[model samples]
Target: MRHTDDKELIRLLRLSDYAAFEELHHRYWLKLHKLAYRKIGDRQDTYDLVQELFIEIWEKRGTLNFGEELPGWLQKRLWFKLSGFFRKRGFNGKHQENFRQYLENQGFDKCFDPAELREVNACYEDLLAAINKTIEEMPNRMREVFILHRRQQHTVDEISDKLNLSPKTVRNQLDRAIARLRRSTEAYDATALEILFIVWLIF
Candidate 1:
C-alpha cells in the first residue's frame, strides 16, 4: 500500500474529503497529541485540545488554502491555542514569550536530555531519602504535622483545623521541618536537582 503524502492529504481535507482527513489523523494524531500533552500536562485538557484543533480544521476547511505548509500551519495553530490557554491561567508576557521561543528555537519534540534527566532523578531520590530519614527521627506529632502540612501542600490553617492544633503550632512545625531538610540537603552542590529540592523546601 502506498502512503499518502501529507500535503496531498491536507489538500483533500480542505476539499471536504473526510477519507483523506482520517488518513491524516492516523498519521499525525499521536505525534501532535504527545506534543500538546507535554505542554498542557493535564490528561483531560490534552484530549480536549487535540479534539478541538481537529474539529477546528474541519469546521474551517472551506477557507483553508490547500498549498499551505502543513507543519508550519499545524504548529502555528497549536501554539496559538496553547497560548490562549496559558493567558487564561495568568501567564505574564515574558513567560509566554519564553515558551514561544523554546518551542520555536529549541524544538518542543526534543526538549528533554535523557542522561542529564537521569542524574537529576537520582539526585532527587537521594535528597528525598535523606529528608525522610531526618523526619523519621523526629518525635511523633512533629513528624506527622510536618509531613501533613509541608510535604503534602496543606495550608497551616487546614492542618491545624484537622489535627486540632493551633495554626501557630502548624507553622512552627513547618519551619522546623524545612530547617531540618535544609541541613540534610546542603551537602549537595547547586545542581538542578539540589536547586529543585531547595526550592521545594522553601516554597
Candidate 2:
C-alpha cells in the first residue's frame, strides 16, 4: 500500500515482523544506498557498511529508537558512521600524506605484477576511502613529523633535519602516531592473518 508510515513500520520491525522490514527496505533501498555510497565513495564499502548497519538494526529490533522520522534517524546514524570511519583510520594531514607518499615510495606501480595491478588497485582504493573532511585538522608540525618518521621510515634525526626540528620533538610525534594507529586499528581486534581468515577473524 502507498499508505506506509515509518512509525508503524518501525513498530512492526521491533516485533520481528519480517514483512514490515522487507517492505521498508524495498521502499528505501535506493535512497539509502545512494547516500551511503556518496559518503563512502566505494561500492563495496558502501555495501558493507549498510549491511552491517541493517544487520545491527535487525538484531537490536527490540531496542531500536524511532520516535522521530525514520529517514532523519537514518541520516543521523549514517553521519555518525561516517565519523567513525575517519576515526577508525586515525587519519590526519601528515598521517594521510605519509600514507600517500609511502604508497608512491613503495612504487605501488611496481608492487603488483602489471597484469594483477588493476585488481589490487581496486581493492586497496576501496579500503582507504570514506567521508571525513577533518583529515586536515591536525597540527602542522605534528602532521609533518608523524609522516616523515613513521610513514617514510625516516630515522628521528633525519626527520628533525628535514623539518629543522629537534630529535626529541620528532620522537614525540612518532609516539602520538603510534598511539593513534593502535587505537584506530584496534577496533577489529585482529591481526592481518586473522583478518585473512587463515586463522579466522575471531578466536
Candidate 3:
C-alpha cells in the first residue's frame, strides 16, 4: 500500500476500500496540514481543516476526478477550504485589532465622536472600494499572485509552488501589483493613504 500509486489508491477508494483510503490519508496528511497551518495560522483550525479535507475526499471519492496528479487535486480542494474559512471569519480578530491600533496611532481617542467616527468609516469604505476596483482591473495572473500573497497571507515560496511559477516570478508579480495599487491610491489624502497602507499590511 505504501508503494502503490495514487490512481490505484483512488480506484480502491471509490470502491470504499478502507485500507486504500487510509494509505492516501497517510501520504498527504502532513503536507496538507502544513499548508493549512501556514494559510490559517491557527493550530486547531488547521487540524480541523485537514481533517475535514480528508473527510470530504472520502465522501466524494466516487465522483472526484483526480487525474494523474492527486497532490495537485488535493491542494486545490484545500485552497477552496481555506478561502471559505477566511470568508466565514471575515475581518477576523487580528484584523480588527490592527484596525483599532491604526486609529489609535492616528490620534483617534477611545470614545470616538459620532460625527468624526462616521466620517472615518465613510473614508475607509471608500478606500476599500477603490482598492478593490484597482485589484479587479489588474491582469489575471498578477491579481491571483497578489491576492494569494497579500490577502491570503501566503509566502512567496508557497505562491510559487501553488501557481507552478518560479519564486522570482511570484515576487515580480507582487512588486508590480503593489506599485499599481499605490498609483491607483495616489488621489487619496495623506490620512486615506495611511489607511490604505494599513489595510494592505493587515490583510
Identify the leading candidate in terms of TM-score: 3
Over 54-107, each residue of candidate 2 has an lDDT whose tens digit, in order, gives: 777778889877647787677556655544554464334433343344444434
In angstroms, give how far residue 109 of model 1 lies from its true place.
Answer: 22
How do the residues 1-203 of candidate 3 rate in per-residue lDDT, one tens digit apiece?
A: 99998888988999999999999999999998987665456788889989998998889888988867898678767756654564465445543454455445434536442122222322444455566677779999999998786667687899999999999999899889878877777776534434444343334
Position 9, candidate 1: lDDT: 81
**Reference-based lDDT, residue 132, model 3:** 63
Which pairs clash in model 3? none
In terms of lDDT, which candidate is stronger, 1 or 2?
1
**lDDT, candidate 1, 70-148, per-residue tens:** 7655755665555445435433344344334433332332543222322233344445456556776877888888767
Off by over 4 Å in 1: 91-203
By lDDT, the candidates rank as 3, 1, 2
Q: Model 3 scores what on Cα lDDT? A: 0.69
The weakest ten consecutive residues by lDDT in model 1 span 112-121
The TM-score ranking, best first, is 3, 2, 1
List, in order, the clash count of every candidate structure: 0, 0, 0
